[model samples]
Target: MTALIMLVFSLASLFMFPLMAQPLSLGLAIMISTLLMCSLASMMLSSWYGYILFLIYVGGLLVMFAYVAALSPNTLFGSGSPLLFFSALLVPLSLILYLYPLKDFSLMTVLSDYSGFMYLKSYGSELISPDSMSILIGLGTILLLNLIVVVKICYYQHASLRPFNEV
Candidate 1:
């Protein structure tokens, strides 16, 4: 199934994280993995959700790329070990997947049915329904806590992330 292939590619890309030596390479790897994940999400859920998720990830990655480009020195890319390793790992994974088959792994079956289509349509609304108010409140509280923590950290006069003032 497409989802299985995406999952395998995502895992393979993630495995390269530890092998990355440069900030740029790491960022590139992260972007690739995020893309695969978003594609998988699109297949399993709604396309709109995956599109939004990918946009958010791209925004974050842009910020990260800017920071790394500014703070890190330009370094030549390392040898092709990562690619070789990735290819090596992918072959075995593909072999295993081919050898051991899975049943009903594709979301196309669910999407093909009218009830399933309706369920998917209502899935978004269910999240914010009255019954899930507690979950929303909890998420809000967590975000508030995170904001407070970030503000506290950034408020320090000598914080590295603080904006520079023109002398």
Candidate 2:
């Protein structure tokens, strides 16, 4: 259920990009909403420690999003800004940190291995091309990560909650 919601929001974010007259604002909103929803669901379903870490992660995302949104194209730090680039870095970083507690190296390795291939197609494209392949890759990565997390949570929950009769 949570995975579905995350997937929906991620797809929405991708579609929203092309329609954004103010890309920064729209991107910020979509990012914040995505982070907020993920964190909220994690808090409700995971341990307290997980909730705390999720909150911190979401906070950092919000700060970075705001920073990117504040810079003007003419400002010293503005044109061809690295803020979005940095935010992209955060996606995989947060996934690694969040899943580290699970100690599921197989899942992490799979995600990491595919991460480069997932975005590599964009490197060959011309800068002026209106195709938002990078955005699609970013969204896909987030959805994949969310699915892994949800599966991990469900597996553990089922194991821990099993009744003595079932055991």
Candidate 3:
């Protein structure tokens, strides 16, 4: 039940992304939503997975925040009527949730009951196992490709992201 509520809140926070006008506020909202999602993942999956997810998200967020802060103009953030907007969104969300019941699909309860199972003994070990090698390779390949693409994009001679003073 708690996990379900957390999921709802996470979704709500994600929905609020478009409402944020300032980059700083948007980054804050993204961080909050990522935290909520990581907690939800921890409850549903393993704590290790949640921790990794949070670290990855936060690392990417840090880079994005640095770039946004450097490029965007510093503007005073005006207070908006968030209470009214939140209430408006909350009422509809609550109505939908009430109309459609959600079942607690968290795996923690099931795992706790059969704690001695051999197959489920170690969660992280499967990543390095031979059976999952191809998946790992594929993920690495994708990441490498993404890195190359980003480097290529940023290396354009006339691009805004070029070296300082044409170094």
Candidate 4:
């Protein structure tokens, strides 16, 4: 029940990220979402795994925040409608999940057969296995591509990436 609630809240906050008025608010949303994900992972896998994952996520977020804070300006304030919408959505989703007979589902049965808890334990193990080296390399490649993209976007003189200058 707690995990479901966490998932819902995280997802709702994720949806609200773009609606945030300030860059700080967006960063807060991102941090909250990431923390919620970490918590969920901790429940499914292990505390150690979640803690390591969270540390990595927070480290990346801090670096990204530094870049964005130096680059992005505070734009116009956003409206409150999305908050209300998320609130409405959260209640019903929670209720449905809470009342639903989740045990009866075949998916849960299969997951239970694999070291319990939705196969997350085995999945985490597989991630550390030799067969998963490609996954790690793929993640590195993605990071490299992201750096290349950011560099490509940086050379242009944009009002967003650079602070204002007075004549």
Superposed Cα RMSD, model 4: 7.1
Off by over 4 Å in 2: 1-3, 18-24, 36-50, 73-167
lDDT of each: 0.62, 0.43, 0.59, 0.60
What's the lDDT for candidate 4?
Answer: 0.60
Span of ten consecutive residues with least summed lDDT in model 1:
145-154
Prediction RMSDs, each to the true structure = 8.4, 21.6, 7.8, 7.1
Report model 1's TM-score to 2 decimal places: 0.64
Model 4 alpha-carbon miss at residue 119, Å: 12
In candidate 4, which residue ranges exceed 4 Å CA deviation? 99-158, 162-167
Question: What is candidate 4's CA lDDT for residue 131?
Answer: 34
Task: Please rank every candidate by TM-score, starting with the best.
Answer: 1, 3, 4, 2
Per-candidate clash tally? 0, 0, 0, 0
Query: By TM-score, how accurate is candidate 3?
Result: 0.62
User: How much does candidate 4 score in TM-score?
Assistant: 0.62
Q: Top TM-score: which candidate number?
A: 1
Best by lDDT, which number? 1
**Tens-place lDDT digits, model 4, residues 1-167:** 67778866866765565455455666676678778867765654467877897899789878877786666555665677767877877887677767773432334335546664545455566445443343244334434543443453334575375656789
Clash list (residue pairs), candidate 3: none
